[model samples]
Target: MSEAATRRGTTSIAPPDLLASLDPLLREWLPRQRWFAGKGRPVTGFALISATELLEPPLASPGVIHLLVQAEQHHQPIHVAGTPGHSSAPHADDCYQLLIGVRKALPPHLAPALIGHVTHGPLAGQTVYEGLHDPGIAELLLERLRLPGRLGELRFGRDTRVDIPFGLVPRALGAEQSNTSLVYGDTFILKLFRRVVPGVNPDLELPRALARQGCGRVPAPVAWFESHQPGAAAEPLVLGVLQPYLKGSADGWELALRMLAEGADFSGEARALGRATAEVHLALSRALPTATLGHTQVEQIAKGMTERLEAAAQAVPALRPYAPGLRSAFDALAQLGAEGRIWTAQRVHGDLHLGQCLRAPSGDWSIIDFEGEPARPLGERRMPQPTVRDVAGMLRSFDYAARSHQPWAPEWADTCRAAYCRGYAEASGSDPRTEPVILRAYETDKAVYEVLYEARHRPDWLPVPLAAVRRLAAPDPARDPGSGR
Candidate 1:
């Protein structure tokens, strides 16, 4: 976390000598927070694009914090855009982020609380917007929503391109760990990289590869945006990108929950999802095909997680209970590695939980979100550990949904689990008997990672994954929980 990672409206008594006035500035700043998104720290590193300072009144305007352009090396710059809040003080520092081609600003009520400052590079149009309040914002905000950074520029390969249609009203679709998504209309969604990892976004990179194999289920890319130049200090930064949106598509987890809710009879649905996923795997194999899973990668998965779990235990002692046992599991994995696993690494989904899968109303199951675990490094998420790793991610989702609404008994989760396993096996064409050992190992590895994640984030949910670790660490049941097949 950087020093400037948090900046709620509050100011330090010895606030920095920035140009903006203290009172009005702080008052307007507080409400712009993303609850799960990190908030509350003195903003230290800042560059400006344009400033639509509201020197007047009534919920000061600009309507929404739609977009801005001045430059942190801004792409499209807009200089002054706000409705002007009432203020008696004289303003001096006139620098502003340039919001390019500002046709309109949003209605007042719908404006988001926090808006961008300045942007630089490869952009054309611009707008400024405030944060969105759940119940509703003023009308100005609703009218003014900025299109995400340069959707026009995203290029997946030398030939393929993505196009985003305007006026789609792509509202914010809660973010995954790594990316913040906004779904526009019923057609497309834009995933803005939050902590951009280097190379190309796996979400953008691998999907293109899968698409090349002509996979039907994965949302085909319409466009992609990336920083022309990688920042020396920034390994992960959102340049921007867009994808064909699956309006009625349900993620694998949500789908599982629905099946569980409907009495755990996802035979048809699960089988379809399974078939679609298997076909995807096959398509991936054809695209950036690989031959074998390396021992190093497997050991790394286990070893890496064990280290993280150990580190987490240091911070949260409650996590200590599972550490020793987990280490034993990792030790066991060390003996086997990801040895002789028939599947090889191509570009696999880094994180393959139910949340990652989208089920369209048409009954076609499409997978999305190439960016792996948001917390892990880009390289880590992009790496191919084991095919079962992805399978385990889905299985984990099944457990989550089963017990999603019911935490204590988790009876429902069992049903979802059974459906998921059945689905995976049929789809992947694996024999149930063969996959369990490997799946259990992968599950253990995944649980360890989850343990660390929960311990660090939702301490209350720590048990959600910790409990998984305990299960994974237990004796290997006859069925390979790893292979959904």
Candidate 2:
């Protein structure tokens, strides 16, 4: 039997014919989606992993189908030695979760969600669209969370200690990347992970661990959903996580930008945020295992930083000139490691930045999104690293915010960064500034990563990190207060 026929024989929920016909529409629609990561690449084909009919025709106004699809993209081959005769794979596949809605006549309000009109199949002549945009279908998904149960291989789970009320109106968050989020009546927010991976996502894992440790700095996970494939030997992939929504909270990035615009002092807020971050780190360290990097490990860490700097220079030509200066920073770290210096590593907010924080109306800072760099492998992200890495990321964010605002105020970022470090020292009893070499190296490494990131993703934002690169590469006595020049 053909691939389509084999998939059709496996599932009885969504019609085989309807499932088979969605490939063409998905190929076009998926690339246009902001959450789709495989942009700029050709979608060669799609394979149906599983399709469950969430709401069937006649039973529901608009039919809803929960689809797990593996999309294959054309892979460009690289020349390698002794591989001239080796057969090359044509494409690479990535799994994506899509909730598709089918209706005969799409409502005017839902015109934005329309994928296209199905041409020929069981769903032919039907208006197919993204289901999350349809209010009724969105509500249905929330209902699944409210009543925890199993539907085929998909499982819904909720925290028994918490009570989640029913009938809350759902609205999708507009400015989400890498995932889709739904806010229900300002009480709860459900984040659906877009790219499916066969492991417990850190976003869910870390928050749950922090909640168990009684850490109030992070929103507690109230419920979640996951799916297990029939033959996969790996862990079940986490589909989504539901947590309490902080009402009347402003994101740290927005707060910083607003403060910068108004010429307001953000030192106090930055200090408080730093304290909150320290508390989270302390809590995580108490809850999870931590490792201390000795000579070998520290050397390995320095080598990794150096490798990243080299790679970034190769990718972004602008970084090439600053490579020597940046390599010096890494070299300093290597020297310190060679001298047998040891550093502590622990579970941290791997991807920390101003945007990853929120200032609640109560003036408390809450951390979210523990998922590390999205581009890195999952195993690498899961590994514990020096807490200073996170500190460097946030410090860079302060610089980014200042640069992003017109008429940049370098003094403002400096003040905020210093105050933040002071607050962290007060809370953690160890100041990051005291360890200047490691801290500076981490900050330099982070800026190098950002240079490459901004170059690839947002060319307009490239200057934000490049400015840091210039400042970091060329040490000015005025900027480096800790340096006894």
Candidate 3:
């Protein structure tokens, strides 16, 4: 598999075993990997869309891959992968063979326009070309990238092109923000989720409920996939979500770090972000569904935290010092369970972090990615916790923003931390009294978990959470109330 040096119209010496070319084995292999989106998916079969083999010289050195494989998804070919496997496959040519899938044959009208793309160039001492050159094959290529029109047909409306169709054989846009994304023809994006939680994925459910509840800011759901005849596992897995891609938007973390690093005043930005985030919690409470965040749920979550913490301590010895303290905090919170006060439950962003939020255009803060922490098993993730747990998570994130922005400068870290808490309190009208016990408990729990988390994945950043654990054990100096309200 030598590197393709040029591009041009191509020829295949051996008629590809369309099945081998379909890459069924690769699809089978995909579901088993960590990076694959179809976690529990049962891949039935694959369809082949005549891949443009740019180079396959006899001495092409066995396994160096430069491929453009169009694989079938549900019997229709799609531009599935651009690069090879997460790691290179076992057999040189055989590994790439599984990357193939099917393509839908496009309608006759689109033929002429699609065929215009077939051209020639040098790639691996050979000529490579793709586009509608094989009008028959090209039509098959085009159909796999599109869907039927609004009703009976399958093409998206013509004007849907964002990046528009380029002559480039489309590539499967990989996973992002915990959801799978595929950019086809540069006109549409397909998002798929790996963990198929039984109930509705909150990403769609809450946003739809909030929009009906008049909550703005969520990208309105345009099209969704759910079985009309619901199956045992028919909780819509969010196969794809169609929304206008935010142009010129940096993820909230990137924006915050840039703002903080530049020493720019972020008072207004902090306020707006806090307001929107607070509003999200409030909205989750107000509209959408509510269940008791009661003792039953609390005890289960406590047991889980205990298990995870104990396991963390076992695996990462550095986390031992905080185990007793972490256990104490959990026990103290469990006291509420003994008293039967764990009753307030609302739908929450299971995992809320800076990376999950976006600073959209117009300076509005938009929170996306409802999928919980990836490492947690699905059953554990579905458990209900206090909505303030989410608040606690984000509050921790603001601290993260400052610390992450300038590791060397401790100056003004306190000021930035206070401004953020100030923003949250003012927007949500959060009272320290109603949830004081639980809020502190949750925040403490978050910091301890952060300590254990940083120890494993990022040893360098371990001290931040260690310091936070110390700060939480003592009163947060930044949290002193002016009016005691």
- Higher-TM-score candidate among 2 and 3? 2
Better of 1 and 2 by lDDT: 2
User: What is each predicted model's overall lDDT from 0 to 1?
Assistant: 0.50, 0.82, 0.50
For model 1, residues 117-208, the per-residue Cα lDDT tens digits are 32322111223333333222212221222222322112122223444334455466654443456666667665655333346567777777
Write down the TM-score of every candidate: 0.68, 0.92, 0.62
TM-score of 3: 0.62
Q: Cα deviation of 231 in candidate 2 (Å)?
A: 3.5
Ranking by lDDT, best first? 2, 3, 1
**Residue runs of model 1 more than 4 Å from their true location after superposition:** 1-32, 35-42, 47-107, 114-128, 131-170, 174-178, 230-238, 258-264, 289-291, 294-297, 338-343, 407-412, 431-433, 475-485
lDDT of 2 by residue, 1-485 (tens): 12221122124445467666887888889989987867656788888777777666434558777888888887654222222321223235878999898899888999999899888877777888999987787778877776577776788889988987777889999998888999999999999988787786888888989998999999999999898778757578789999999999999999999999999999999899889989999999988899999888988888999998887776677778889988888888889889988888988888999999999988999999987877677778888889998899889888888888889888888898988898898899988888888888999998998886676668788888888888788854234522211
Best candidate, TM-score: 2
Instruction: Give the 10-residue window scoring lowest on summed lDDT in candidate 3.
Output: 87-96
RMSD of each: 11.9, 5.9, 11.8
